[model samples]
Target chain A: MGVNTSGAAAYWNLERYAERVAFVDEQGGICRYGQLQSQVDEFRDQLPQKRQLMVMVSRQTVPSLVAYLGLLQAGHPFLLLDEKTPAEQRADFIERFRPARLIDATGQTIESTLLDSGLDENPTALVEDLALLLPTSGSSGVAKWVMLSYDNLQSNAASICEYQAIVPEDRAITSLPMAYSYGLSVINTHLLAGASLALSSASMMERPFWEQLREQSVTHLAAVPFQYELMERLRFRQQDWPALRLLTQAGGRLSETLAKAYTRYACEQGKQFFLMYGQTEATARMAYLAAHREPEKVPAIGRAIPGGQILLADTEGELVTQAGQPGEIRYRGPNVMLGYARTAQDLVAPERPQELATGDLAVLDESGVYRVTGRLSRILKMQGRRIDLDDLQHTLAAEGWSLLVTGEDDRLLVCLTPGQNSEALLQSLAGHTGIHRAYCHVFERDAFPLTPNGKPDYAQLKRMQHESAA
Target chain B: MKAENQILNTLFTQSLGIPSDLVTEDLAYNSLPQWDSTAHLQLVMALENHFGITLETEDMLDMSSVAKARSILEKYGVEWV
Candidate 1:
């Protein structure tokens, strides 16, 4: 079984793994590599022969996995969107991008009307290297997509396999949405390593998710900070699933308290715990704290991954040579995205070397590990999903509410003037923004505190959150 | 509604930001968009605070619906009217 070792090599040569298990269904049925290749081939044959753009409603299902490989193998660069995306948002993307086809979660493919009308008749107009497009902001209803090439995917996958030392025997259970870069990386890196995956959409809150984890003998598990919180609440330490070996965390910073707790568990149980950091711009991960570093660097996001460099530069664009000085974390790597795409025409934008400015503030420890201090942007991640506060504020203002939105990683606090209905406003914000109402809190004040420049004093607002929360 | 049901209803309404009338016994986790995983966590925290009892992992995971929640609460000595 010689590896293809070329562009998009994983999907291009699924047969190389032969009878090894590729996917474990929710019911614990195994689909070997040979059968998976056949399924991808059948699906590829059904797709349009010409290279084109497609939109796929992605789920952590085996059929969706098959469609993904089929699309990649057929050379169709598709946009992967969450199944929970609003119908209006999907329709808006369709109207703006005019994708040639739409593949629903059930693996049903529907050709667009534009395909028959001869609009943009040549699909090859897109950049030859473009392989996938992922939405930059899922909750904001923004249509900006991160354009990724086959090289970007391959390099990142290979790098991840190198650090994690994933083997053919590892079986990962999908706990995150495949639409997300972190989740998609789990699929890509595992398949590239000839490892098997258990496709389950059940969340950590559900008993079935744990049942499947034990049933499938899943070895590798990936989660975000919020999911780690849930696993804590779920008393993951009490579980006796012996096969669980590797645990990876990303998507956002895990609180120091939780990080230490997991580190202790991994040490006691003799398992690996990796605290990683990345943005969608860098494919999936740029750095991970090696497990051997342990309790000493429990919360630090360790060194840059293989084939990548993690550098910190101050706001003046000078490298911060001294330790303990915070700077914007930057990553230069082959996994950097081709660029961003706001329109269909932007897909053809030429490729160039990219260095991702990760808009995050972190300081270097004496040992060269990076400890993230805070965010440079007005964004917060609740339940592993990034929410842009500015975008959310605009959405609220459009609906006749002007308030100060500020919060930590776990919750969103909005300061409102008195006489506003807090419950109604919170409900509307959650419903419109797809942020759960539980994470949205409201505080009332006669007038908001202002900075010297008359801008809403975000520092004061954040202070108010503690007083109100207590 | 019984006093127990009323207390439960108030907690669900305030925590989930849903109307009290929608918090019926048949209301289940993941059934209402508001009663999602995050909301469920909030509800559990609220229950622990109100009942003054920490729920174990099995107790939390087994609490799937309003009816199931009441039964689980009873195990912690919460009485129903």
Candidate 2:
């Protein structure tokens, strides 16, 4: 494979780098640069000629990757679907969007003939500008997609490459699902920098994951906090990696103890450990704490990524310059999504808002590093006063116990590790907030439930409460 | 219905949201998408409440399948008819 770097190339132009190695498979088979280009071209030929909305169940495979790239190059904006999406949900989205073509798991284009394509009626205007439609969160549906332009993807990838110093020599393994924004952004940034990727469908719990990662000589890796916990459970620290250069944590907040442990491990091993934070609205990366400042084990999410700006907005929507006063974390960046899609018609004419009001509450310390406090909506109203559920959970967390806080209007359910009594935790909550013990329900669980994305599925816990109540 | 099957049926349906028909001897954790870690927790909590037996951490983590859960319950002195 000949990787040509003769001129500046748009990261997505597969044809431009026809000679480089784009992906390495589990069997150690290499998919070269030109192969991806040819595959993209082949996929482009298979699509229906007319411009219509597309719904793709994005799987992590050579065919899926090439088809996605092909559709993007052909200027087809698509809604990426998780494979686990239920049949009824799929039918509902199909009915709502009336997508012209349905790209099945095998990369076959099936004529969705369910309804007349909705986007085709006013096709000329919106189809030209839209590039991608990602879910606002894990559970978002047809009515809610974060509309992204090619510009949004390109700018966010550029920002990531800048902060992380990604070069053409870098290669990252696919640790997250391709349907996820964070995982998709890894593909975007690496492609922008003309880097390579080693794709794997295996979970970290398997021995094959490490064997293949080593075989591919993967250089950089990123994961959610729960993955690190899994790695710890798997005794990953004892295993040595000679080629790995950068290790990053995102998707959710890692505990200070684990963050410090990984940071120390990275520092001692001469590798860079990055603590990052972002929301789906602002692409994948918004803020990153660099490795140079690794003396403290507890890392703060550093300043905004190069192309973005982070500010603290008070209750009145005013910027707070002074430190320690917490407010909603506000991010203004080019990568901020082009508004949201409620219907098929909403896809046209980029409606990107200037500022993204991140629902997370955070405060800038004296050193200008932002420490996320809690979420605005993760609050519980108890005794006629608003109580921060995260703050209450942190009380148990401070006691070095792993727990999950979830409940309804009047009570909060705290699920904790088995064999341990929640009496202390319950008393502490009552002592701090003046809420009665009756309002708190404590159950014993071995550990918190992890979602598909490797974050604690607090939403699932809430659903359990509702289901049990019903 | 057998004592074990009845207890397992209610646990699988009401607690884990598994279809009552799908709750069988062959049902395994992660064997189906619906029986993920979250469902596993719900099943564990429900089993504890119904059987009046608290599962330890090691036992909870090791409850991988319906057969496995039944075997573990037997070890806890849960008699099966």
Say which docking band candidate 2 falls in: incorrect
Stretches of candidate 2 off by over 4 Å are A1-8, A139-143, A295-297, A379-470, B1-30, B35-81
Error of 1 at A431 (Å): 2.1
lDDT of 2 by residue, A1-470 (tens): 11122224556787666778899877888887888888788888887666667888876677678877877777777888766666777788777667788887678888746845655766775646577677643221223677877777778888899988888889999887777778888888888777888877765644456777788889988887656765665456778888898888877677687888888888889888888888667877899887546445255787899889999998999998888899999999888888887667676665769998877788898887888877667755332234566766676577686788875545678777777767677666655554445557777666677899897788788776566557
**Chain A TM-scores of all predicted models:** 0.95, 0.79
Using DockQ as the measure, which candidate wins?
Answer: 1
Which residue pairs show collisions in model 2?
Answer: A2-A19, A3-A19, A18-A34
Residue by residue across A410-461, what tens digits does model 1's lDDT show? 7788999888888789778777566777677898888898999998788799
Candidate 1 lDDT tens digits, B1-81: 124657988878877768888989899887877777777887888899988889989888888898898888888888878
- The C-alpha lDDT values of all candidates are 0.83, 0.73
Give the count of colliding residue pairs in each prediction: 0, 3
Measured with C-alpha atoms, the lDDT of residue B65 in candidate 1 is 90
